[model samples]
Target: MASLGQMAAQSDMVQGLNAGLRRVPPWVLYLAGAGWAGWLFYLAATGGLGVEPIEALEHRYGELALQLIVVGLAVTPLRRHLGVNLMPFRRAIGVLTFFFVLAHFLVWAILDVQTLSAVWADILERPYVTIGMGGFLLLLPLAVTSNNWSVRKLGGAAWRRVHKLVYPAAVLGAVHYVWLAKGFQIEPLVYLGLILVLLALRSRPKATRLAR
Candidate 1:
């Protein structure tokens, strides 16, 4: 446990940090996300992503989506425990996460599979792909409703309840990554463990309202 003085100092530091964050618009994240995605795509196209550029690009996008999911989940806990508020950027993070997820799917479907029928077959036959698709489907509704108008229409309680879909979707995503790995790799397991820990943290009594 932190002493009162230490906690106060931490709080002061967090306030300063959040003040800096406030000066930056959330749309900046969207622009950065778009630029990063374009850069990755360019790398894949120009042989910068190595021999198996398509696979690399697909994996990169999926990994980014997963990382962003982790970030989105962390915002609440960070604010509650450390007073490091990130509420303003959470929505942008979520939307960008979905964009990366969609990019991952497109790269796999268009560049790797190269056929609509094959993509369908993979979704049905491959357990990992099936899990990933399920995660994507869950996020779809959340993404659609991630707006002020939807919040107004659904009511706060209903909107929060619907957004809870992220929990299961995150689990499915981690599981998908674990299953998709060629062998007993440690990296996917680390992501799964991190996600599980974050989810466990969320199960605790809420010190603050969750940010969308």
Candidate 2:
């Protein structure tokens, strides 16, 4: 158990951290994420991302989208359990996740598949592609409504209910990754396991809730 003074210090530190976070606007993340994505594209174009630059770029963007999804899912748990608040940045994180997902799809459709018919064919014939496309479609509505105007128009409870699409979207993303990987690769499985664990944590009530 922590002493009163130690606990007080920790509380002060968290407050200070949150205060500093508030000073940073969410648009900062938007600019940084866009810049990073552009840099990755530049690297791929310049042959700096290995021999299979297009494939590498697609993987990078897809993996980054997954990471952002995980981070978005983590915000509530972190605030509820660890006393760390990231609510201010959750919308930005979500928007970036959608952006990266779109980028990943564009890379696959234009660079990898290279044909409209073949792209549609893959989505129909390939299970992984089908699943990934489903995830993307699910995110599309959420992304479109990720604004104050939509919230005001839809109302709060309705907005939240629609946003719950993220839950299944996230699971589909992990499953798509696992299905897309070759052989018995552990990396994709690790991502799937992490996503499942995060979902489970999100579903479970916090100690404070139980106390109530």
Candidate 3:
């Protein structure tokens, strides 16, 4: 197996993507996030963000969030199996995952439902919404403690325990997507399979026993 850096270098997809992404300063990622939120707002104000828009937005956001979660899960495996250097970007990717999940929930609550009462009812009555909310809830603590101080305060073991919620989060997220679609579909199934495999890889004895 190739090292993480070697893996990154070998793939045109990764290389091209990282080449453009590397040019972005840390502040630019922040700005990009703000820009995404602003654009969503603009689309809503212009009546471009309605049911179909919300569906599209949430679909994309959910996909991105899943990818980030998977990437975070892959870090240890990549480093161990491939001898990759993935530590530096792990936190950033995790943070971005949280950000996208937040946006996904916001778009659903604000743009799709447009009322707290409606959102509340959906959470109560809708299985998809409930599962989605559960996934979001799982992400909350991880997002809040992404910083070094929190890690130090919580200790690595405790923090790792909290972060393990990502596994359930991913499972819930896939179920949410499948329920939302109302039927079996290729895309959601593919993601579901990928997430399961990634999770299984992380759950192996060697991976499981490795200390953070």
Candidate 4:
């Protein structure tokens, strides 16, 4: 069996290969995220980020969050199945997922409604918004407790349990997407199916046991 350092080194090699294939540095990813935020601000300033803009922006944000969730979940499986350690990227992806979800909520609240009371009412009365809000709430604790101190405070078992909320959050997120579409759509359904498969793969005894 490989030592821990050997395993980590091998994993780093895998990550390097993967990153090289994409030909984009980690800093470039951060730059892209910043560019996205800048573009949104520019649109808002130009009176373009309103109802239709809100719809497009919210959909993109929600989809990005979902993709990040999928990527985070994939890390474990990639490690187990390929001996390619990706644990380091998990935290970054998870945090970005939370950030995207925040953007989704903020766009809805600030751009779509522009009134706290109206946003509150929609969150309470609209099923789609309610579901989305619930997912965001679930993400909140995970985001807050993602740091080293919080993990140390919670301990491994407790911290793992708290992070497990991601499962339900993913489900709620998919439902929110479906509900927001207001009709059956192939793309969202595909994402829902992919999420379900990822969850199922992650839940298998081999996967769960290996994760430990």
Tens-place lDDT digits, model 2, residues 4-61: 9999999999999889999999999999999999999999999989999999999999
- Candidate 1 lDDT over 78-162, as tens digits, reads 9878788899999999999899999999999999999999999999999999999999999999999989999999999999999
Q: After superposition, how far is residue 129 of candidate 2 from its true place, in Å?
A: 0.5
lDDT of 4 by residue, 75-129 (tens): 7877777755556557677888898899888887987799999999999999888
* TM-score for all models, in order of appearance: 0.93, 0.94, 0.77, 0.79
Candidate 1 wrongly placed segments (more than 4 Å): 1-5, 206-212
Candidate number achieving the greatest lDDT relative to the actual structure: 2
The lDDT per prediction is: 0.93, 0.94, 0.79, 0.81
**Residue 65 error, candidate 2, Å:** 0.2
Name the runs in model 3 displaced over 4 angstroms.
Answer: 1-52, 205-212
- Per model, state how many residue pairs clash: 0, 0, 1, 0
Show the lowest summed lDDT stretch of 10 residues, model 4: 21-30
After superposing candidate 4 on the true structure, give the runs of residues whose Cα lies further than 4 Å from its correct spot.
1-32, 43-51, 206-212
Which scores higher on TM-score, 1 or 4? 1
Give the Å shift of residue 134 in candidate 3: 0.4
